[model samples]
Target: MQVSPIGTFFGDAVYKYEAPRQGRLFAGHPGRIELNAGQNFEMALRDLDGFERIWVIFQFHENVGWRPTTRPPVPPKGKDRVGTFASRSPYRPNPIGLSCVRLLKIDGLTLYVDEADLLNGTPVLDIKPYIPMADAFPDAKAGWVEEQEGDLWTVLADAPFDAQNRWIAERSDFDLESFARVQLSRGNFSKGVFDSTRRRLTVDESAHTGVLAYRTFRIHFTYDDTARVVCLQRVSSGYTAEELQEGTEDKYGDKQLHRDFITLPDFRR
Candidate 1:
């Protein structure tokens, strides 16, 4: 049997690292699923708006190959890995994932969803309404999660960081604040939910400070291990003074963004 995508999801999450652990992590992030124009999907979408949430069946298009076992965010004690089927790792044999996203509205062939965790240009295989009565299994025992200690931390933005994040968000589609929370909230500098070693990050655990690279930008932050609180200090450009100049190459077509960013009252300076 063969499978085909009925639509595509477009959003600000362009990279895997940008995606939150779950859609509920950042409720402000929204996306649109544009179904195939002439496939009569409009009829299929009839009455879907009545539901508050929907199950988005999408493809993990960027992931390649499959792993029999995968590492989880909060791995079990004495073990760093778990069966792939037990975890939500994208490196699956089928490369398909089901994400429950809030349905805001539907216009023409587009379905507007909020708090989406899928990356931009994700191929959507199907859509299903979320029925709480049928889907709600509150007491279900999660194998490893039940055995491990609660591993969630509170993430915050400092005064300077909040201002910087707002300034950048107004100028571009990047939400460094939310990304930082999703990536930093679950783990410390040494061991993170997303794994700091795999990401573009520099950690100074001694000082409780670290810098996380988000695309062309960098986030400076501090963490209180005792309180389990992570606070973002500020955001800086990953570009140099020379790279932001007019004569430099615009590889990612974001040189202008960097140039404009440097003029933000020298916030990170």
Candidate 2:
């Protein structure tokens, strides 16, 4: 019954670990964990240079509840809903998420990581080194995941923050074409009939456009050609289109939001 907020997430941008079965699914897409207000985040990471991978205990901030049975993204859409603990869905009652990510490098409090399957600003609970012998189950039987046809770790940096200020300041139209291309490269959209249609859609409305949840960002793009921005809201359980739009507008609207992208590149020492 104990719970608390982990350190806030930071990096190029909040990313999606699309189809990770375990943390091993991603060997790239790095991230970092920074202190929220009072703690000394840098000191805690001072001795972490030698490790290759680490376990990240985080909150499924967007997950809402648990169900006795649920359908995974794998094949066979309808299946018996199993116990909540049996699946990796973020909707569990506790909403705690755990993943093992590779450690590429550490600069002060900033950690260059790989295989980070987390949303932007995910609250980190703790960091522990990965012990392969103790963690991996080579003969593990993936009850339903074995049939899934995709890898979640396949990600690319999309949703540009370059013109974020312009969009916020001018409230003018901004195109998501290049941004969408980047996301597509990372395999964000699934290869299904729904995806086929969703990707081809177009949007040209203001109400439908909004910022991403949890971080300083705003992405307004068309989905299924219905004039709505693809939802980039962050949550453990899931998000509503309205909620996603609201979060984006409420948070990201300043110069500090884009500071990391500029500062981190030069602080590598």
Candidate 3:
């Protein structure tokens, strides 16, 4: 058995952990799949543009090994343990992944897609058009996944919070608001939401607040127990002035471009 990469996926999700758990969930950025040139790949993509969505078969190149049992992030509070095959855990025997991404456009051998959960530089093994009648099964039972409530909460950023996110985006390449939305929308604030060893969400009894840490930034938010709403208060970057200054050039490009973007009348509002 032999396999080779036909193309590579390029997107904002540079790290595996930063990618959304699934496509159609928190995919806020578009990505490009540039097929290898000189393989007649351009001719192969002739009629692909007509399809609205396509199936991307890719390899989980970052995964090192397989696990027989894994705990999924969104399992019901008490029953978190499940066989690896039952969940979409990346630590699979084959290390392969599948995603249905919306095909935005096609430029020669390059494909523009949205709702992609793959990380940047992910090797794409194959691509196929998605057929609605053949691919969709809305009424099919989803086993244990169906048993969970899986209710997504409403995530909102207040004016000040939005401002803080914009400020952070200008300084760094991170999308604070999108990351916050993805984390808080799970509505899993209780202690049992995550495994005891890997605690991702923490609540402060005194302040009635919950904090989700991402990289060097901490997202401050409050979860309403009654309303079931997660209000984003602000995003505080742990990067020092020197770190931010350095990132401004490397990650965010020219400082003037960021300044111009931040000062725009529309962005200011």
Candidate 4:
């Protein structure tokens, strides 16, 4: 009964909260799996590149323990918690996870990937090419998920927000635009859409403005309640001037990014 990782995943999701509920939703966020050398894993990876997608069996290394019942990201109607086996909670019995990630390319032992929901440095057990004939089941009934509403809010970004997001992404691994899309796109708006409590977000109906916290950064956006549309306006530093001051504590090691962020042409220093 022995198990070991064939490789390690390097991705932008530094924290658990940064990862999307599903990998497919995190499309455009790229990552790589650096397989161990001298094991002929490169040969193992041969012929895998042609497949557009692959099933990655990985380990949830950060989860502490398993919970019998875990709260889902978007809970079903009238159900606060579901059986651990039912939901894709990281706190599983064995901390094992499976994600179908897009295969960009393979360079030697490094497999370029995208749409990965696993956190940074996650251990990958194995990979298998996805077969559309064997996996396609569009007609399949999704149990609790089917009970939820199907409508999704359209997420847009203004010229300014787009500029700021691009700037930050160039300096860091995170992608604020995609993160916002995944979090704000779907949910029951009547019951506080996008898991406001867990995601640390607030909305001002009067002003049509909403602010979403993404670790050391803040996303400011405006929404049209009637249209179910969210338009990102700008990006800001969550840290105060004092916090970003010289010799201050850098809890997440990203204060420097914020320091330079405030200098954006439109934002005040």
- Expressed as tens digits, the lDDT of each residue in 1-269 for candidate 4 is 78899999998777776778887864777899999988988778878879999999999998798999977777788888889888888888898999999999999999999998888899999999999999989999989988764367899999988888888878887688988887777664445646665567887767878888888788898877678888988888889998999799888898888887887677643
lDDT (tens digit, per residue) of candidate 2 on 212-247:
222223344333223222543211112333534433
Q: Tell me how far the alpha carbon of residue 134 in candidate 2 is from the true structure, in angstroms, after superposition.
A: 1.3
Candidate rank order under TM-score: 1, 4, 3, 2
Candidate 4 global CA lDDT score: 0.83
lDDT over C-alpha atoms for residue 120 of model 3: 91
Q: List the residue pairs that clash in candidate 1.
A: none
lDDT per residue (tens digit) for residues 113-201 in model 3: 98888999999999999999999999998888876644677888777778867776766677877766766676456544533233255
Best by TM-score: 1
Cα deviation at 151, candidate 2, in Å, is 8.1
Error of 4 at 19 (Å): 0.9
Model 1 sits at a Cα RMSD from the real structure of: 1.7
Error of 2 at 217 (Å): 14
Model 3 is weakest, by summed lDDT over 10 consecutive residues, at 191-200
lDDT of 2 at 144: 62
Model 3 misplaced stretches (Cα beyond 4 Å) = 194-200, 240-269
Off by over 4 Å in 4: 196-198
Position 234, candidate 2: lDDT: 19
Query: In candidate 2, how many Å is residue 24 off?
Result: 4.5
TM-score of 4: 0.91
What does candidate 1's lDDT look like per residue over 200-260, in tens digits?
7788878889899999999998888889888899888899998888978989888888777
